[model samples]
Target: MSPNPWWQDRVVYQIYPRSFCDSDGDGIGDLRGITSKLDHLQALGVGVVWLSPIYRSPNDDNGYDISDYREIMPEFGTMADFDEMLAAMHARGLRLVMDLVVNHSSDEHPWFQAARTSRDHPLHDHYIWREPGPDGAPPTNWEAAFNGSAWEWNEPTGEYYLHMFSRKQPDLNWENPALRQEIWALMRFWLDKGVDGFRMDVINMISKPWRADGSLPDAPVVREGFLQPAFAMVCNGPRLGEFLQEMRREVLDHHDTLTVGEAPLATIAQGIELTHARGGALDMLFQFEHMDLDSVGGHVNGKWALKPLDLRDLKQTMNRWQQALHGQGWNSLYLSNHDQPRPVSRFGDDGRWRVESAKMLATWLHLHQGTPYVYQGEELGMGNVAFDDIHDYRDIETLNHHRVATTERGQDPAEVMASIHAKGRDNARTPMPWSAGPKAGFTTGEPWLRLHPDHDSVNAQRARADPDSVFHHYRRLIELRRQHPIIVHGRFDLVLAEHPLIYAWTRTLGDERWLVACNFSGDTPVFECPAELAGREARLVIGNLRAGAGERVDDLQALVLRPWEAVVLRLLD
Candidate 1:
């Protein structure tokens, strides 16, 4: 057997600190709230807790815009509260992974403040600054991910700075050796404080392409209203590998920690190089290919418009990643995070067969060969919220797109609202439902965002007590990963890759083989054993529903599956 690291066998749970739990009734979650909820996470059987950014910020892009990396946000708590929370998590045998937002810092950060004051400042080269175009327009025809131009003009300085995201965030220049050392020192400080790992946000965009004379030429415009695509030059730049390898040699080599990069437009080949064990770059990367299967116009249209998802395309995308990275690297499996809508609402049936569909998705993702990450509230089958009006939306991305679509594009307000309702980041940002009490047991005061109304019927308190709840189903899946080594190291083979409604695959390790099958739709589908395992005896292992005494068939025959039903069986030779 190949030796595996501690993180390889463990599961990660991501917690958005602002919406997790509120302890002081301040309408926002705090560090003390996270400390009080350690027992809940321990009971859920997750080994790693990946917390979103809790650092001092201006709240422009939630917590992603960091003003101070060393200090905790006053709303979240003080340094003392962070220490207490970290101690509590370690005491419960749970590892903590912090979100590293070094791709860009808030405009209010000390480094940026000093860099923007004058051209001859000591930290002037810390951020990317450029002169206006020949026509006195922005530096380049590049657009930010959150809409608008990528370059923000500084009236006091007479130069523009680059911002791939919002204007409040200024991109850091990794080409500066002193700035790189400063980041290394900050990482060492956190490492000494006992942080187990880091979830690097937009780490791929740190190194940007620049001309020999430091000139940024305009990109080819693709659309009329939209700016040219800048990711081609911003992502996976020339010096990315050098910077990551240098970081590994300086700060990460002596530590036993996990690192995952949030790569937005990375391809499979890029993922392989970034995560290769010998490359010394990162442990794994979160690619956005599978997430865009339902997008109407690909990356340009963003996630606002939706289209029908083709099962064949989905299977091909996932299979390519699994096969390419089989022995060279690792994969991070997930369906939803703070940036996207809920998986149950987007991919599965969230209305009538919510429970079954949730379990089916868990089975389909966990049975693959990789490390699984469970977002908060996903285990309980929590779904998207229904907001009728645009006023109910609070996400900056959603509001910005709504305005651009309605006012700039002359689209109907009702049509924009419908798209926002179907695909909005706020769908995954609602407060976690702890109980049936007011505010869904999230806070004593008004929540930062509204709670889902269905929390009354679907919550932790009720699910924990019921034996047949989605929470328990997830627990069983986690246990299986811990007990079966094959689930972790087995070779993946796609089965029924072209099926329209049913998804199936197999994992094999020497003499042992396991089959995982699921129905994606509400209609009953017929499942047939593949020809390769036609004569093998099938033994029922774990399933969503228990089979009767005579219901277990040993021969390869046709069997009908219920809506969103998932089953796992071992084939004995």
Candidate 2:
């Protein structure tokens, strides 16, 4: 048997620091606030904590537009506070993973400032700069992820700089060897500080592809505004593997750490090459294929417009990834994060059956053959917020999209607001509810953003007090993974693949097999054992509902499942 890496079986919990907890009673959460919550995470059975960006920033993109890579954001805390937090996490046997956002930097960063000062400056080539077109417009029709043109003019330098997200964030030029070395040194700085790993933001977009003549080309127009989809040229470029392997050799080989790259447009073949043990590229990748299930018109439509999710598409996408990387690579499983809306609101029912649906979603994701990630408030089954007014929104991307849709595209404001309410990132940015207090027990002062109105009934304190709460259900699921080797190493086989309301699968290891069945809808359904599983004796392991003595199955048979119910059973010969 091969040696097991520390991360293979570990459950990772992601904390959006700005909304996790507030220590100084201020409106924002800080490193010290996270330190205070270590016990909560430990009790939840999480072995690793993956924090979103906490680096110094101008708040243009909520910490993604980093101004200083080595300094902590003043709003969060001082450098000493970060050190103290790291020490506290270590003492509690929890590893820390920092966000690495080297794809771009804040315009206020010294390098970008110098680059903008003059074309003769030594750092002028540090970022992607190009002269305006002969028509005095942008060099290309490439559209930004946030709605406008990707290129922003710098008056002083008489050149346009590329920004994939926001104008305040200027994309770096990875073609420069000096910049690569600088990034490697920065990685070394964090490793020396004892960080266990990095979650690289848009890491796959570092290596951009240029034309054979060394000139940038215009992308194919996909929208009415000549908004070309630039991701095709920007993501998983030709030299991405080369750059990742080089970084691994120069910086990562020296430290015993984990690295997961956020590759938005990467394919399964690319994922295999990036994470295969012998590939020397990365440990794993967060692919977005499954996340785009509700997206229409492919990548051009983005996530604003929603479509009814097809269960067949979902199953095929997941099964492909699991089977492709069964032995050669690893997978990172997640349902929601800072960039997504609440899973219960987007995927499961958040109304009358919130608790039951949340538990079912957790069971479905955690039982998959991969390392599981639990976002903040996920264990408590927090639902999405319903902000009626546009002024209540704080996310830059949401605001930009609203403006572009209503003002430029002539879309109705009410219709745009409806989409925003359903899929906006702000839904996930609300302050975490620790208790049923005035401000959700997140801050003594007014929160930076509004708290969810339903926090009174769905807070962490309330869940911990109830033995049958969603929090306890998640804890039990985590514990099950640790106790059963089949869950971590067994081969996966999809069962009831075409079922519209039920998701069922089985994991087999040597002579033992575990069967998992989940009902996703609010209606009761009868689930029949598959032909291969017929005539096999089974023992109930864990489930959301109690199995009475009269209802227990002594032989292979069909079972009536309640709304949003999930069950795990062990097959005994």
Candidate 3:
């Protein structure tokens, strides 16, 4: 058997294709645009590039609504372009992992089209369809992830179909054996092309709650009249484990693949079971427990209901995962993704302490025991865009929320806009600021979405030139991980667990030990070294402070840290 997949210790960089770079002058990013940026990935020291969906799509839900499983999106380029891109990645010693969105398919897809045309169609059972209730209401009071009802009426079929996301993206019926076979075939199609693996989008949501009598249970009402979120009604359903295991046997077991499942709302024990090496379904899991800390009632209020990030709460969450997954499975570490706002804006200070805070966040994430994911533009200390106009936003989720909040709920538009500015997914979808030129050099033509106004100050061209840029700090962090085996296989223990602003942790492997500490605020904070490490000789392996990349100290009893200052010290015992 393979000792461990190469992706175990490699850092994965996620590229949101549409906003990464636009090479065709069509104002949209394509395969050629991504190929042009291979050198950047190589220099950044990331081993794997997780390319977002480029499959044939209708652009509804921005390529997540896949219409054709085997073809590339015309706007993104052709099948030939995909092949060339893959070859270029391999030549540079970089592995490519494609996003696997099997939970749903575009309404325009042949199967969905045929399924919706008539109730007697052979493909009708390929999707989940249900007769309306006696009052002509939807089958269940289940809300889609984006907004509105989870069930959409099919006029021709005289029934409503399930859509956990947008109406155009209908959820697939996994209970069908034929559907499973077809999915397995598509998996082979890409793996045969030599791509590394898959990042299953909402993989746990495939096996939704289906009763023995063929009825989907109604979601519990959070409020009196609103259609409640179907998070519990559909997510992590009974057959999730069985389906994943079947997928492994049919597709993953045949290839040396790297599988990371997006398992929202999963507990630590569930994560461990899903990613177990022997009988498990995936190699890693993206848990949202840490991401949910700031949101009070996330499923009910959506992500817009924001709260301040408590360093102590963050420490507890991370410590639990790190300590639990030490030997059972692996963690997929990330601060933000394509569907979330920039980390600098959310977790770190994006204004007064931008670069320092970005570097500090990177240090905090990479210092732990997990495969770190660098979303596109994250390494450059990019922050959220201040799009004052709702027209400037492009995400369906954001637009839907604005409509519901203002028109339906009678909410103040300005207050709603503030929430959008804080938690909008469009914040992460801004065009990559490659240079401080017109359109930030992302495109020679008009960009599909408005570029961040601050792109002039924060761009890759400038960050790469300055040694103190967050880009270089990330490079150093990745380099350290590659060089030190302890960083990958070490056990983590939280220090100063109760500190409100000072987040500190230690990693140990046999006789080797390393201390990592960071001040999460603008105020200077002192990290009183732990008793075991106090008075021990230590060298600053890497730091975000202005002048301490390799400084040494004989005694480590107490050290003052600047605002957002982060330090990694190799305890010389």
CA lDDT of every candidate: 0.86, 0.88, 0.90
- Whole-model alpha-carbon lDDT for candidate 2: 0.88
Error of 3 at 352 (Å): 1.8
Q: Evaluated with lDDT, which candidate comes out highest?
A: 3
TM-score of each: 0.97, 0.97, 0.98
Off by over 4 Å in 2: 1-3, 222-228, 547-552
Q: Which tens-of-lDDT digit does each residue in 465-564 have in candidate 2?
A: 9998999889988988888888888888888888888888898889999888898888888887788888877778778775421234566566778999
Q: Which lDDT tens digits does candidate 3 get at residues 373-397?
A: 9999999999998788999888999
Ranking by lDDT: 3, 2, 1
Ranking by TM-score: 3, 2, 1
lDDT of 1 by residue, 1-573 (tens): 124778887889999989999999988988888888888888888889999999999989999999999999999999899889989989988999999999999999999999999999999899999988888789888888887889999877899999988999999999999999989988888889999989999899888888898887676756775445676558888788899889888988878888999988888888889888776488999988899899876776677777988988889999999999888888899998898888888889898999989988998888888889999899999888879877887888888998888998899888788778778889989998899998988899999988888989998999989888899888888888888888888988988898898888888888899887888889888886678867767776677765421235476456567899888888767
Candidate 1 off by > 4 Å? 1-3, 223-228, 547-552
RMSD of each: 1.8, 1.8, 1.3
Q: Which RMSD does model 2 reach against the true structure?
A: 1.8
lDDT of residue 422 for candidate 3: 88
